[model samples]
Target: MLKRHHKTEALILKASPYGEGHTIVTALTSGGAQLKAMAYGSRKLTSRIGGHLSPLTRVELALYKSRDMDIIKQAQNLESFLELKNSLSRMTKAFFVMELIEGFSNTGVGNRPLFDLSLMSLRGLQSSSNRDIEDLTVSCFQLNLLKVTGFMPELYTCVECRSSLNSNNYNFIIDIGGLCCTKCLSGHPGRAINISSKSVEILRQFDKGGTLFSELPLGSTVELRRLLDSSTGFWLDREIRSRRFMEHMNSRDIREPMSAIDMESV
Candidate 1:
């Protein structure tokens, strides 16, 4: 009997050129599994899948089971977030978000919450007001991703003694997954990142599902960024390339002049 496989709708998370004229596409299916397949002749100018299979494009695809790799028979475009492509900042942020998802997600894991969060993050990136909002969205996504994946850090209490955290300064142990009160900090050799009260409050808001892209307190944003970056870096065991790109953009933001009107308004 011939083997059988079912078709599914997926969003292309990453894609790269393969062999001579083909392309390898990695996507997150609507069913919440990562799917990898090859789109033959995709590099050719006349290929129908040329523009449709690019990263971040939602597509409906037909797949056939094969011993080595799955075969992509047909592809139809569902939703193309064109705005992300139009602006460099938006594009970079979106790519970074996708990279995080791809890096953390498993091939056959069916996580509906993470899947929904990814889509929501993409939509926020597409329509974000400015770079600040984009940064906050990314931070929020990172926090939520860790939460859904069962890696959410114990931020409210000390990771060591389980005591309530009321300290002005915190020692965040990435491997242990949250703040270590001063007492705990002294015992461990983990890298520590400071956390301010305002930052802790902001994290609490995120834990409570506050609005994405809201006006963030600058201090809070900075602290949250540091916490997430440090935590993710330690847990993932390597630097994420997209994060370096984000840092580059942030540095540029620092050099840009702020309008008097903006300052007065804030």
Candidate 2:
């Protein structure tokens, strides 16, 4: 028995060619569940759904439930992030963010905070000045993702003894999802990353949503990159290819400074 479903709003995260003239669209519905559907003839030049099915485009799609895959009958674009698509850096960052959402968000789960954070991250990337700001935006998104997924690290206290963290530098254990003071670090065998006091302060700010990318310091930025990488990698148990690309992009940006005009533009 086949079930016919009407239209629903969705944000396209990934779309790839399925067959000769069709495409497979993977989207995150407003209800916070992942939806995969086949768009017939979407790859053709004359196809009306050509531009509307691109990643990050919000759309209303009509789908029919099939045994293995859902079939998309029609799609109408709700919002196209034109600004993000126009710039190469912005596009790459946006894709990375989408990849994170696609990889972490579970099917049939309703997480409004994750959805809202993803949308905000996209908008931030679109308007961000340089790679620095872009990295901060992604870092923030990753932190929020962990929080929404119920894996937020215990920053204010030791993961083992549950003692309040002081001004001393600590070793962050990715597997434990928090910090380990000098005593705990000696006892545990997990990989440890050094975190400075300033970095901890910045992380606290991130948790509170006080100041964002522009207000973050260089050291804090570096610490955040390390923390997010190790933490997410440990929990996910695999490397995210998009994150590698983002690292490459960040390195490239560091090799060249933005022009005075470019800096002024942001």
Each prediction's whole-model lDDT (CA): 0.80, 0.80
List where candidate 2 sits over 4 angstroms from the true fold: 1-3, 213-215, 253-266
Query: Residue-wise lDDT of candidate 2 within 24-70, one digit each (tens)?
Result: 99998877778888998988888887668988898988888877888
> In candidate 2, which residue pairs get closer than 3 Å at backbone N, Cα or C atoms, i.e. clash?
none
How accurate locally is residue 210 in candidate 1, as Cα lDDT from 0 to 100? Answer: 80
Per-residue CA lDDT of candidate 1, range 1-266, in tens?
86657688888998878999998898888776777888888889988777788898988888787876787878899989998767767777788888878877778787778788888998988899888888888899989988887889988889889997766676677787888888788777647777778777777788999876477678778878888977766667778887776566557654455457433332
My TM-score estimates for the predictions, one after another, are 0.89, 0.88
